[model samples]
Target: MQLTSTIQKLHERAPRLGKALSLATATGVITGNSIGASIPIWFMGAAKTITGAKIADDTVIKVTNYWINSNNALIDNILPNKDWRINLPDDVHSKGKYLLISNHQSWVDTSIVQYVSEKRLPLTRFFTKFELIYIPVIGQAFYFLDFPMMRRHSKEAVAKNPALQGKDIEEAKRACALLKSKPFTLLNYLEGTRFTKAKHTKQQSPYSHLLKPRAGGLALAINALGEDIDGILDMTIVYPDG
Candidate 1:
């Protein structure tokens, strides 16, 4: 671990070092996640993009999943609590195609999904915005993983331009069609974004801890994938200390 020496030194020199140790570990995790993993993943993804073979794309997906697993392992190492209790179905098959739906909270939700579904679901990919391709590293990685990149058209815009009415769904279908060749899990956050107190109040959400669920995104997924989707996995997550 990169922070091990520094944390030990801080513990030796500082009277109150608990927070310092935690901070160092957190820093290390961030550095390792971004640098130790994402940089290489970016280049590998670029290589995957250049190739025209399905086998190459599958290989890239496997690598990305391994990257997620590595990050999950590191996070577990950094956390003080080792026991995470979540009820996942016993029938969830590793080789089956799945649509995983969950509530979004903090940025940590991605990692939580990766950790919980690691061995249970086929390495999960999330539906991303089409504009995310403009981002540097993460965009490239997501593209390499072949996650469906949705191009959303506003209702008003679609009404004004009749030609664009079903364009978004067609693009989604094209983007998601790649998953048909392999068994994979795609995660969709039903709320469409992270949950927040302001958003909840504004939406007048019915759920106690969740924002109002947006059916449009799920509809897009269903329309795009048709009957290719194997099954659904619904999850509820909570952070007690929040």
Candidate 2:
């Protein structure tokens, strides 16, 4: 009798659940495409070539800011949610150079962060894997926009090949040096990966709220690009409920 009652309740809710899931998926896809891969290939490519990219000149800064503003408008039109908000300091300026740190939770976190902070900060860029540079359109766009593509060497890999130890950091520094012309934000996720219960249990992490923080990327950014930084933005994003 109890099993039959549970089945009836699930059957009643199935359609509602399915509809909700479908809407969520559609919303995600629209938001992602509106701001991301939908962007044209030659837009930034032409800008880079025209300016010679020797510096973040007037044209480069203008185009970059325009792209960010257009994306923000698209996000507002599509995902108008009151749940997402950012509390930036009163003195935060769009032209200020920032080292931003945040917790990694979902793939969607990047879009959320960019949308919220876009007005108060420069268009944020993260260090991407060096291999992403070869992926055609998106990779070329990232390069033109001054995103640093880094080649990280793990401890085990570095141990066996001593010559590879600091090469990655050196390469990142060389890339970042070109970004001195304009103020920008460099974002890093301290935990390095999204949280999972199974992985958490295996690692036996100490914190109830966060995974263990990794220092490699943070260290390299601070050490290599420290001199130009104006302020550090430590943003803590908390979800409702546990």
The Cα error of candidate 2 at residue 96, in Å, is 0.2
lDDT scores in order: 0.77, 0.71
lDDT digits (tens) for residues 1-242 of candidate 1: 55445554555567367556676767776666666556666666666667766666666666677777877766665444346888877788778988888899999888888888888788888888889988866787778778888788998998999899888778777777878778888888999889999999999999988998887767777776778888878888888887
lDDT of 1: 0.77
Q: 55-168 in candidate 2: lDDT tens per residue?
A: 434454555566656666544433322366568889988888888999877787787777777778887888888888787656766677678888878999989999998798
Instruction: Find the 10 residues in a row with the least total lDDT in model 1.
Output: 74-83
- What TM-score number comes out for model 2? 0.74
Tell me which residue pairs clash in candidate 1: none
Runs of candidate 2 exceeding 4 Å displacement: 1-61, 153-163
- Pairs that clash in candidate 2: none
Model 2 / residue 85 / CA error / Å: 3.7
Which portions of model 1 miss their true places by more than 4 Å? 1-51, 154-162
On lDDT, the leading prediction is 1
